[model samples]
Target: MSFLPYALAAWLFFVGLYGIVTSRHFVHLVICLGVTQSSTYVLLLAIGYRTGKKAPIFTSGVPVKVGAVDPVVQALTLTDIVVGVTVAALLLALVIEIWKRAGTVDPDELRRNRT
Candidate 1:
């Protein structure tokens, strides 16, 4: 197994984490969170990948004896993507509400303006 995908996933995770930690705006923080979650997709795909295997779709031409990539991993990745998008949408809505109330999207300013 190659280590490139794993390394790439780690790099993406760390970059997103750094962005989250340094984020000032609520929208930016949400975007960074999405970026962090995307690492899981790469990791899952890497884990399920086979060098020459076909997708887990069985057909008349493709016999069951022939190995296929894991379907569970692909399903999980799709689920993760859906959940991430949902969460990002919710967070964006919250940010919009916060901006309407406080006239600012900066987290630091929001904290200062808190009642």
Candidate 2:
């Protein structure tokens, strides 16, 4: 049962790779990037979950133990998510600008014009 999520995430990540390989449009590539980003998030969160661990909190009457998921990993995941979003947003913005200036988003066509 624990491996189910991992399997699904792997499958989704492969699909995203396929899209990136076969993409003919810039917008489709951006969508594929989003898909891959989500796949990593699912994988990371699944790996950090514990079967019986309580939430991370140190109350006066309750004690937090050593078996809880690492907060550092969680923080890294959050940072990765933010960075991915920033990259995707910047790429999309560049795509829009390229479309406005060149009137096309095809990478091959852009290369053609570079000559």
Candidate 3:
């Protein structure tokens, strides 16, 4: 049970890498990049997780020194999600432009036309 998250993260990373490697279209490559970024979020959350800790919050009835899950990892993951979305959007836009100019989204065709 404890190892599930790690395994999932690794799987996501590998799948994304495989997709990227075998991708033929620029749009498919952009989507694969997103899959790769999702693995980091899972890994970060897994690393910061506490087995039986409370949320990192102050409450009147709770003990002042009770163990709380670290909030930094959650914060970082949120930031990463925002940045990743922005980057994915930019990449998609670039791919659209490439398709417009090249008349095709195939990577091999684009490379051939670049010469």
Residue pairs clashing, model 2: none
For model 3, the stretches where C-alpha displacement exceeds 4 angstroms are: 59-66
In model 3, the Cα lDDT at residue 11 comes to 97
lDDT of 2 at 68: 75
Residue 48 CA displacement from its true place in model 3, Å: 0.5
Q: Which stretch of 10 consecutive residues in model 2 shows the poorest summed lDDT? A: 64-73
Give a tens-digit lDDT track for model 3, residues 1-115: 3999999999999999999999998888999999999999999999889988877787799676668887899999999999999999999999989878889998888788889
State every prediction's TM-score relative to the real structure. 0.91, 0.81, 0.87
Best by lDDT: 1
In candidate 1, what residue range of length 10 has the lowest lDDT sum? Answer: 57-66
Query: Please, what are the lDDT tens digits per residue for candidate 2 over residues 40-103?
Result: 8778878887878755565697655656764665776799899998999999999999999999
Clashes of 3: 0
Better candidate by TM-score, 2 or 3: 3
Model 1, position 108, has a per-residue lDDT of 83
Q: Which is superior by lDDT, 1 or 3? A: 1
When 1 and 2 are scored with TM-score, the better candidate is 1
lDDT of 1 at 28: 89
lDDT of 1: 0.92
Q: Model 1: per-residue lDDT, tens digit, 4-103?
A: 9999999989999999998999988999998899899999999999988889987788558768998999999999999999999999999999999889
